[model samples]
Target: MTANWTTYRELLLPGLTGRRAVESELRRAVRDGRLRPGTRLPSSRDLADQLGVARGTVTSAYTQLIGEGYLVAKRGSGTTVTAACSWPDTFERAPDPAQRWRFDLRPGLPALNAFPRDEWLQAQKVALLALSTDELGYPDPAGFPLLRAELADYLGRVRAVATRPSEVVVVNGAAEGISLMGRVLKAAGHTSVAVEEPSHFGAADMLTSHGLEVRPIPVDDKGIKVDVLSTTDCRAVLVTAAHQFPLGVVLHPERRHALLDWARAHDGVVIEDDYDAEHRYDRPAMGAMQALDPSRVIYQGSASKVLAPALRLGWLVLPPDLRDTIVERKRLDDLGTGTLHQAAFAQLLKTGGYDRHLRRTRQLYRARRDALLDELSRVLPDWTPIGVAAGLHVVVRLPAGVDDLAVQERLARRGVNAPALANYCRLPTFPGLVLGYAALTPDRLRHAVHELLEAL
Candidate 1:
């Protein structure tokens, strides 16, 4: 997840007081290795304003740190923690998780390098200027009306999600959306919820946390087994119908109808996690299952896959009857997502900037995916790539008798981090690795695949 500069500011600002205090904090941070080498200090003027100190005080602290060999400042480059600062041996410090790998092919990460910073900043500027004083106040716990409206319309057009502004309740991200669903469903007499057998482990943990038994229903090439689901007593099921996670399959059209029929017959609900609603390569991705039965499907969408996850933006298009309860749950959850972000995203949506971003990233991701597939065929001809060519990742089936877990370990030793497919499953499944291609260039992806070949 990406933290905005403002988030970093909030995290670093509290309890900072005088020049000495600032110096003390910086020294402690650097000494403990929390402030790792090469970390740039905030500008002196910005630090002064944020901390209510004189600009010269910040400059003094910088000078003191520099003189002591803790920091270095060049003419063009800002002040940075110097290599002279000792890496704390006694402290349990670590680098960013991705830094551990030479190539990060783990599933579900978007291309952070390709994030549209300029366009987002422009949207934020528009939002900030347009927001009325009243709009800046505590928002309706459900969401900002403008954002809800924008999300409703955007989802309708892009994913064919059936919704209205009143039905959309903005949450922090899909994680929170799932948590809210778990809480609400469990409270409303739902004892168990069915999830795809090979599904997001974090979501299962969330459901378990809320006292709901998460049943792992088997998924086939056609998607989740609705026939099997019909026999179960679970009243709600979470699905990635648009582009099934990890596997990247779309829910088959007949099965889609059958699942909704099951919902109608059994008084069940579907939590449609449209995690990768767009980003399809070969063709237009299927519309969300939420469109088939709005009363039964709770649609979940987020910017995590399209934008940087650090943005922490997601929404739920709720059933009319469930809207009030979910919105009330959101009220108690965090009063609502931050208004500034919501407003900025609204501006992005309203101005068509979001669509432009999608168009650009779709092409980039498609090219990267092509490079990976082509390399796999050339170098590892025996490996089978499964599912549609429509997501950030592709699952490659290993030759029979190969242990994917062992392969993953070997890849880890080689500084690559492709996840074993079996780890995502509750039941036994085929041996394979889930490779994410979005974050890496075509050349890097090819290099990673060669490394995989070596590991094999």
Candidate 2:
């Protein structure tokens, strides 16, 4: 299909003043199938004359289009649309009407809609302007020095984590921190690590993938059974001491002492995931277990729950002995996390912006949590909510003979999303739903609870 000069020249009549504008018109024509494959175009000189534009503009457009595979120009051959150019008929896949939900109650998410964008942008601007030329070069693998120093001070003040700036290593997120720790432990001749039963399954999978046998230790209202962990042949244990995932119970004070004692007795290690300690509502914030025995415990904390998950910013306060190996592992993993983000976060901490944001979000999340509980009580009083003292989620225990997975599926069909508690466990123990209320407003949560009841 050879396009004559008159037919194609008319297509380029509008908005053909600049080289880029000419290129855009031609590109659009080719993409929309007006200039079909194998259609020869007019000479650049002829097109420029016809469109009343400079010849160089047409030539530049031709060169760009040729480079983009939209046009082919060869020596001793005229310019033509590429024979291979094909635009497929594209359509968006329609969503399943039955599966479209009005609310999402799945766990481990922050209220992203409430993120402090202006504060973060201002912080970034300040950090960049304040950065010295030497500071912008290849970043220190451990972390940005300012960020490490600020985080050291902040963690000590807020979580009672005892560590110096030299002891902290910034990584991508909590997941990468766990992976790095697993590799470090594996290299140290450790074969097995114990994890809380019905915990975040991703932790277990990461340990197994790193060639460590994962032994599950059951968790009750008091958190992981330290007695059972003592009996295991594992040399390391991963725990969410502040706020247990999916279950939400704090590690009891007695269990905390027993865990440290067991670690001391066997020369073992404890990996503490202090994921959402800052979101506590009902009581004083619990200090991290790492404060008790920094030599035997590795403390990991992330900004995912407080700030935004997209930040992928987390830090590890390592025991002095394990510091070198973990830093080496991080250096080999990704060199280091983004330097600019670390600097900005450090600014947020130093200027008290981060703390202010935390104070605001804590209150907002507490209100949402209360609303969710109230709605659940009014709609389904038989279902009991557990672990409401801290964190963004609560587990609602279903009545006898009710299947949690079945309820989850039913909720999905009725436009509500709630994950079954069994999904997080290696072995089934109870039927329940893990509901997160932080991401949605109170009205949306109320409507979702009503829908969930209808599904039930």
lDDT: which candidate is best?
Answer: 2
> Which pairs clash (backbone N, Cα, C closer than 3 Å) in model 1?
2-310
- The positional error of residue 436 in candidate 1, measured at the CA in angstroms, is 0.4
Q: Rate the local accuracy (lDDT) of all candidates.
A: 0.84, 0.84
Cα shift from native, residue 254, model 1 (Å): 1.0
lDDT of 2 by residue, 1-456 (tens): 444576656675554786667888888888788888888888777788878776656765775566456776543356778787775547322333233345678788899988889999999999999999998887898999999999999999999999999999999999899999988899999999999988887788788889999999999999999999988898899999888887988899999999999999999999999999999898988899999999999999999999998999999999999888888888887888989999999999999999999999889999999898999898899999988477889999999888776576555445456877866777768889999999988888888889888876
Q: Name the weakest run of 10 consecutive residues (lDDT summed) in model 1.
A: 1-10
Pairs of colliding residues, candidate 2: none
- What TM-score would you give candidate 2 relative to the actual structure? 0.78
Error of 1 at 85 (Å): 15
TM-score of each: 0.80, 0.78
